[model samples]
Target chain A: MPTAVTPSVLTRPDDEPTAAALIAAAVETMAVHGYHGTSVRDVAAAAGTSPAVLYHHFESKQRLLVTLLDRGLDVLIAATEEALDLAGDDPAERLGAVVGAHVGVHLESQRESLIGQSEIRSLEPAGRALVVTKRDVQQRTFERVVRDGVRRTVFTTATPDDTARFVSAACTSVAGWYRPGGPLDGPTVIARYRAIALDAVGYRP
Target chain B: MPTAVTPSVLTRPDDEPTAAALIAAAVETMAVHGYHGTSVRDVAAAAGTSPAVLYHHFESKQRLLVTLLDRGLDVLIAATEEALDLAGDDPAERLGAVVGAHVGVHLESQRESLIGQSEIRSLEPAGRALVVTKRDVQQRTFERVVRDGVRRTVFTTATPDDTARFVSAACTSVAGWYRPGGPLDGPTVIARYRAIALDAVGYRP
Candidate 1:
């Protein structure tokens, strides 16, 4: 139940360098060294700035991590929402879209996805709650699709909730091992995942 | 790829304290602080022993992690093999058994499973290769069942290899979120995963 008791603060607008650049620097440092292994000084050094500059833009090291995680989740949720829209009304197609979108986004932003998934332990209570809440919202989109499919007899699973969980787990794992120029391209991988997701739900045709 | 260039060494057998106790200590420490964040001193403290005692059992910190990971994978492979044996001839049944045993074993040894999955990056080349070979062997078990099911038309998947990967990913993720005394018990969760596995391959029965 530990929470980051500090209120969210805006990055300094008048800084010499943009906050976006600072955030990008933090992401790279964290991605390579892990959250606990990296420090504000390390990030600033990697970013070609000083601790004073970093502190000017962000309240603390904890805040930098929370911001990065929140931004990553935001990007993921937005992309998946768009995919759901394009999927239209068919539950099977919708689920496939969800899988493809999930895999594609994770692979596209592999580092952020890796940090977001792995570093939940590093967050304080409030930051953790915020991230979890956002994650739950993303999970609900998949759950709703599964529930719809089951209700309509279009798809069948013994446990709908766990079904959704498994699908999320499977898709998210692409980030762990997938290489951009490997045997499978983004579309090829997405197609394969779509097949797997559809097959897992007992979808026919 | 960065490989741990050092060759694997045999663990010391004649150490003052048993290797098992030191391993238990290492697993607990790595589980909390992560591989990079932990040191020999930290593990010794957790194990209630001195660094000299730890060094007697494990050659170095890297060696300690590699040993722990190897042991974890060995235990996992053994348990899954037992599950496969109980599953007998039916491909659907075999697949179900794989998922059930996977989730069950992961939940039972959550910490080791977590560390095993996450810290492969920390291993040296020889150690990394050793671990990857063992992991591939474990992966092949699932692949064989899926391929068998597809050949028999008892289960259908467009890409059997990808299907196996997805299933492995999904089942391993149970260790991430499952709580021991949560609403669902071990068997209940396993049964649910069994259904998902069966459905993923389009198993009719």
Candidate 2:
């Protein structure tokens, strides 16, 4: 179940033109029209290519979708890990770091994050299981932080597992409603959510 | 934008065969196939009726989807209000009551709730605005409670608005994952979430 997609697979290389174009077109179309609404031909047209070219790179539309989702999740995990590394020994600071990173990544990759959240239901059985397993790994990271916080008395939640789920869900949801250049900038939004996340676990600051 | 849908619209009158059948079919289909994946023909066929019959009650497929979502949100709002009424004057108790009712309502009406959350993006412009407006009103309820708690020093969050959004998002996400007859039953799930919610807002005591 640990089919950790390579981070390089997500990044567009100058050498691979078709695959890069196809991924971009898929993310743009699926983010707006949704997975079911966008067909291979629609993506192909958006990419200035043909359906045969799309099938050449990806076997089917489902495969293309799973690839996009896998890449997005991989990027998110990497960002979270980096944030956790920067966070010091304190559990509360670590929790804030995770929230800030979660919100930052989600807003920076708004379209992909939106598609990743909404289109999980569109994946086939096998794809869904793989994505769910990867998602569980990400959730475990948050759970571990919360457990450490509770053990140190820095957090006083009765249900650490539930707290992890709540914080993760809340952080991931920032992408849903947040608009860039709105009332608050990215830094402000991150700061506010970070405080809320710390407070959420009964973090004694 | 204030299309405040009446709560009674969600109830099935038993006498209204067409609308009830249509709603049931839509929920069943959309729950599995998603709003984008489902078509008017699919819903009509599932209901054992023709497209004309569906159109007679609902003007279009988009209209039907919005109607279903509006009713679902209205039901959730009413249930949350009732929970708040029973929670007495304590802000912490009120927060728990809101979370408990939120999880309970989402789990009870799983299909419609799932559709209501995931398919909101598929809504047309006017429909999206109206639904978002209605949703904001619900969020305001949580904000008001959190603000009151902060004023009383029972909650120590600097961002009451962010706390409301975080709690609402976390509670609403239960519908995305909860399965009936799973390892945890409805009451246990609700109770765990209640504790998590209470701790999340820094409720002291």
Candidate 3:
């Protein structure tokens, strides 16, 4: 079950490159095919490598799965942080910009988000808990944005946390149904999603 | 792979006694182990039954999984319908009710919802297509509600489809990290989600 954790430049400092590739591959395959339907070979095939390559990169099939969860969350956090940077001096504009950025990143990494969401349970309990904790941080970040808006009296909301969650969920689920060549591209989706988020939470520009 | 399709029931159709028990058991096992990770034997073991009984009831594992989806959708639809049944014909009231119901069902059946949301790929191509189509229908239903709300001037500004999706994803993801005996129970979660939906969409009561 022991597999290598080979580090790569494309991955986070602690992440192995092969492990990250395996994860990126797993994200594509697992989202398209359920985790159960996918095999170690599928991850290898997608990476233009073999199962030994995957093992050489990670600790075990389970650990590789866990690594993906960890990295996906990391990517999501990084993405969310970037989105938050879009926040401006004005609360509503900041909210809209932030939400747009959030949705933008979601569609940008559609495969990764979809797989992380759908296959989270494939990880061991510890991994599952870690993912949940990271997700909470993401949720809290949204809540903070909404709370700031409310305090400014620019956006009127009864429950900021609930509103934050609505924005979060709507933005995340775009990965599931959005087609690459559809009438709505990622930009359009982000724009529309931002409108929805701002209006839902009553952020007046 | 042969499985029985228990369509009619003497009891309330929503609570399919044996099927509920089976799906409930399957949801827990499937979410963790995954559709591939879980076997009928595992489901039966979790449910305190024999695999023979499961096969006799469901015919095949895939069939059972589909049944779970069918049940979860039924509950979700019913909740939405119930929410739509607001008095005084106020679109805002109806919208809030609908949001509440949507979140309620999602939070209540978090496990089953998660299973259906994640394991959808395990279905045959045709089955998966059917599920996608059904999901679209659900989306359209919410869109119509948003449209009505907008027409009634209950909302400040938003596209119906995007707003509908915003509401939908908000509640749907409650299953992802919602722990039993967590700080927020079903009612609180539903109410909070409802508030979020209302604010996001600009529902004025």
Candidate 4:
């Protein structure tokens, strides 16, 4: 049987230090230069390693990007799941928690969020499928919360799916324009987005 | 006197067909390979022209990108202005119109919208400044309507600016995932977003 590809939110014990270094370098380089503009040599040089070492760890640059995207998604999914766990069964609170976590993650990991959004087109079929599967899980998390809210009559939106997507899209966009020390701090942005998500869903309370 | 740059919604008579062809080619190429990955040679080859001819019209690849970004903004700004004109003075109607036009533009000009959103970072100081100025105008357009709505007590949101930003972000994101022959058509998506924008602002009937 083929080994399963399970993503871990935390740093894995099996992760080689050199491979981790390469992934970090790849994120930074690809964030600036984009996938097509970034070469394996660029990532290897940034990681202070040789192309042979990079190839030893990962088959190619595409594989490196897939790993980066997977790791980013893992972090996001873990954070969201934690938030949902802490929030009680109240649909409004759950919606708030989910949007807050989404905004916080995007703000804290802006580069990774940006790369995940922009570089999906650069991935091959298998890699794209992997990322899309993770993405759908994230999307469905929001949908489930919104649907629950609708079921409980706490949310009044006619289209629960569309509302969930709008909230997700709005939160995802923060990474594109937010600056760490800009006008609004992270907490303020998070709070605002949480409220906006509620408003988008037409929270009755 | 320095020639003041004015952006037009319609193609200008001064627009050389060769230059237009080059810009079209640049959008398609950069959409696929990105700005950093694409060279003047690639754009020239795509346009079926020589690098000498490309340079004759555009001083550099960066200038060509700026022109493309500027033109894209022009089209968006014009479409939005027309929508607002037809919306009358009612805040809710105006909000619906603006978002409808916004989603419509992103759907109709997916390549240009995607390029404009992604390639802003690739621009140099002057080019970035120019695009940012146009973008602020677009942003302020949404802000004004929201502010007006709040003043009239039709929208209950305390943070009109943030609500405006959220609505704009949500609408702008349509370009990233919307497919022509997907489950939802253009009119459906546009109407759904218009309603979502209203819901986001806490619009009152």
Highest lDDT model number: 4
Tell me the deviation in Å of residue A12 in model 3.
Answer: 7.6
What is the CA-based DockQ of model 1? Answer: 0.61
- Candidate 4 overall Cα lDDT vs. reference? 0.86
- Worst lDDT 10-window in candidate 4 chain B: B1-10
Candidate 4, residues A1-205, lDDT tens digits: the string is: 0112122232356788677677777777888888887999998888788899999999999898899888888888999999999999999999989999999899988888888888887889999999999999999999999999999999999999998999999998899889988899999999888887888999997
Error of 4 at A168 (Å): 0.2
Name the runs in model 2 displaced over 4 angstroms: A1-10, B1-11
Cα distance off (Å), candidate 2, residue B65: 0.4
Model 1 regions lying over 4 Å from their true place? A1-18, B1-18
Ranking by lDDT: 4, 2, 1, 3
**lDDT (0-100) at residue B68 of candidate 4?**
86
Better of 2 and 4 by lDDT: 4
CA lDDT of each candidate? 0.80, 0.83, 0.71, 0.86
Which tens-of-lDDT digit does each residue in B81-135 have in candidate 1?
A: 9999887798878888888877877988888888887778678889999999999
Candidate number with the higher TM-score (3 or 4)? 4
How would you encode candidate 3's per-residue C-alpha lDDT over B1-205 as one tens digit per residue? 1133223211244654665566667766776677887989998877667899889878899887777677677677766776676534777676767777776776666666787787787787766776677776677777887788888887765577677777787778887757879787777776677667777677766
- Model 4 segments more than 4 A misplaced: A1-14, B1-14
Q: How much lDDT does candidate 3 score? A: 0.71
Q: Please give the ranking of all candidate structures by TM-score, highest first, separated by commas.
A: 4, 2, 1, 3
By DockQ, the candidates rank as 2, 3, 4, 1
Give the range where candidate 1 chain B is weakest over 10 consecutive residues by summed lDDT.
Answer: B1-10
Question: Number of clashes in every candidate structure?
Answer: 6, 1, 10, 0
